[model samples]
Target: MATDSASACIRQTERFGAHNYQPLPVVIASGQGAWVLDVEGRRYLDCLAAYSALNFGHRHPALVAAAHAQLDRLTLTSRAFHNDRLGEFMERLATLAGTQMVLPMNTGAEAVESAIKVARTWGYRVKGVPTDRARIIVAANNFHGRTTTIVGFSSDPGARDGFGPFTPGFDTVLYGDAEALAAAITPETVAVLIEPIQGEAGVILPPEGYLAQVRRLTAEHGVLFIADEIQSGLGRTGATFECDNAGVRPDLYLLGKALGGGIVPVSAVVGESSVLGVLRPGEHGSTFGGNPLAAAVGIAVVDLLETGEYQSRARELGAVLGRRLEELVGAGVQSVRVRGMWAGVDIDPDLATGHRVCELLAERGVLAKETHGSTIRLAPPLVITAEEIDWAIDQLREVLAELS
Candidate 1:
């Protein structure tokens, strides 16, 4: 919506809100399937899908049903009392992840924090690393979250600027360099954390064979390999994991984004029993971590991903989107990156800006978000039909052509 109320709301945000993000002017009020209805009653195809959390598409009936049923029974038990749905959620999630233990949390960042804690504790209790010396290594161009410790290793200046004095114990290296990771790990290093595909860094994928090499090297070094799959996991990448494409497995997985089925915020650290078991009684926890409402929705999400059709939908559509975007190289596009149903299109800066293009896209009934600079990321719901995807792509093509 770009009406009086919409401008008023935007002005309110500008006045009272932290100016962290420069969002477009459109104001949305409702969504169904892959389409969001702005306050002005304009229906836009949601290409960002809330950064993949709406992978099941906005307001899937089955997931909404699950949320409703859970709300009628119980919502939060807070670990002081056990929730009925937590165990089932953990079991389904662990099975889907091929792991033995699942430690639940509420946000992707909190899940990441939990993974760091688990790694350090596992180093001390199991791997015999010295106390308080355990270190975790991350990559450049990484966006784990905005937590103080997570931002400590961030390579992006805007993310980390003025946020210091930062936390110690995190080392940084290049994104796709396995050798850099090997060299950076000291004896004090307990975990080498990575994203299978760096989403926030313009959808940067690692060099082929890099993941497998890291998997092997981490094993050889007696260091745990931790994966932050918040933005890339749960079939967003066609496979259950983007790491699976390289036939690699990490010791620990930090999962979020799509796990709550877009109904709630739920995340988890799934790992081997010994690794996740490091958290002792009262050592760490969250108020909404294993709450019953989230657990129910999470179980439903796992069930949704288990279907073969869902993964195949992402794979088949991702290829179509990739080919169309690659053709943009001849159509004034600077570059294109595609993995699963996700794509990062780098528009030519000389012609028009990413922000301007996005504003125009919003006007023409498509919604994508800009990342880094000069790049707009497109990740529609996997539930989208081939026809819907083609329609969205045609809209993008028309818009880009008009910009010429």
Candidate 2:
């Protein structure tokens, strides 16, 4: 396809597709490492990574090659027949997640929806909760995915607005507060669903030891714990699993995005066998759940994570980035909270707004989007090098200083 005017393309898309997203002006055509080149051949550093999908960066050669090879041989077998790569992927993902089983799905929302099923079923079968009274506890300001059941539990109004009558049976507690979670659960409560750091809530971190406390409390209550690591897992947060930072073992792990290496849509529910086994044959599935193409990419992604190279990179750069952000605190910067490669920077109310800073960033060759009105999230691909990190940071610092 020939590159057209980005605005024209945007108009065409808005005409056809849902107007759910209000995106920045750039329309990316190609990318490498942490940089994307738009249709007009202007380059911008990719700080969002498709909400953490591009942790390996766009069109990573190895992952692209995997997709190419798989495409040549086979793509989909519909889960009706065994594909050579699916078992390998399932095995690797399960092992990597320290879980006994893996159930593949197409999107993060599907995986989260599947998790809801697992949690509710486990409640009835294992926890002995009444059939209709299976309650799952979620933290406030959590963004699991956009499925009906998932959004039903979201604390964000915009995501859930006008989308109800919502799914019931979910309980909410203050995020990062273990005491609130403990108090919210009754005997019928089956599971506690949480994001390790509440990424969508301005990269909010729980108090130190909060995850550990959550671990202890869940264990004591025998309620399953679920970690929605869709945005933070697979080395995006300087750890294989963000829960590792606290050594918490969740009963269920929801994964997506980076699992497909930016090649295809893939998600999974990794958890103990008994809990996952609750789904009998024909209970739930997708046509492309374990397709060979996605399976191959999933395998490659797992291999990359096992090397520990990217995680180390994220860790090293994270410290430098955090220090740099801290220097901005109380300056034009209102506050900064960083975890691994992802950061949420709060803009000063008087100096400049997050949207303005992001627009200035776009002009300066760094691309980031604003969230929650005043915060801009930074989540470059893990494959970005030290030089690129410095460059992106310099770009942001320059714009922020100018705003100040």
Candidate 3:
């Protein structure tokens, strides 16, 4: 009965919804822990976790409780007036990231956009870059967000083409190449914005010493190092921030995704007062950026991370994941990249595309997504058990064997 209902729902969405995303044929109705139940009443292990927004998993007890408690009291109080929850949220989040200030926003793109504004402003005021000549160095295959200004600097044609009239002041350099990045920097460069791990580029890790080199170069050049940790932060990479794994810290940390605790859209730009303090009262603002509900959820998320249990779990399971995935190389997987509990499995292109592999995995009760062409990313909730991890890997093994 529910499966029939799912077809109707899909048809209705196709009729009314914008054809922006081509989602897999599964109508998820509800989720808990690391699993989601579709409208058809079938369960699927959630491997993507809404791209890490659900890092704590859907309906996490603490986060949901925070949302519910805040809902009963207060929800929205724009930046015009001080909300009770905003101060605590900002303080806690800033402290968690080891920053002195926080600029609350509602989405990942907004956080990135805000960071860009701050960097550009800091350049003119603090770094003394020529007016409107401030340049930000970005990687080649970066996926910051879909905003026009963000996509303007994108190397991926899929995200850049047809979105013309892009904003300037950004230079693209080859990713994971310290030499290229160092060569790209100029006197006008204000910041070097990069992801510690390129999530959208199939969890691409930098060369062993690339991040430390970037840190040194940025500091020596007197340019701000902005780490966009939206997808790679919040215990996703076995640490509070992926930068920790590299033993480097960016001047500005652009954070989101798990910050909202899968309950609300909460994002923030955290940095020292010297950099983030450049913003004046009316310089930058967002109406729905720091609502009470979002603050409550974010505060709860910080509290959860403060325990360090989730980070430990990611490290423990990540080892199991790495061992299992490494075994699959040359069998059906061309290559595998595992960091913490996150993985990017490159399926043999001759056997199937990443999309086809995801479809087969979905049929087998595992949910993942394709990146590039033949790479599929697996980022399940940190709460996932060893048994569940093994199960998902087994499903992938079966899918690849069948296709081969």
Model 3 bad stretches (over 4 Å)? none
Q: Report the lDDT of model 2 for residue 269.
A: 93
**For all candidates, what are the clash counts?**
1, 0, 0
Greater-lDDT candidate between 1 and 2 = 1
Q: Write the per-residue lDDT of candidate 3 for residues 56-114, one digit (tens) a residue.
A: 99899999999999999999878899999999999999889888999999899999999
Q: Evaluate residue 63 in candidate 2 and report its C-alpha lDDT on the 0 to 100 scale.
A: 93
- Candidate lDDT scores, in order, read 0.88, 0.88, 0.94
| Tens digits of lDDT, candidate 1, 1-404 | 47997888889989999988888888889999898887778788999999989989999998999999999998888998887799999999999988899999999999999888899998999998988999998888899999988887898898898898888999998988988898998888899999989998888888989999889989998999998889899888898888787798899988998999999999999989978888899999998899999999998988888886777888999998898788778586889989989888999888688887888888788899888668889999998877877788787788789999
The model with the greatest TM-score is 3
Error of 2 at 396 (Å): 1.7
- CA deviation > 4 Å runs, candidate 1: none
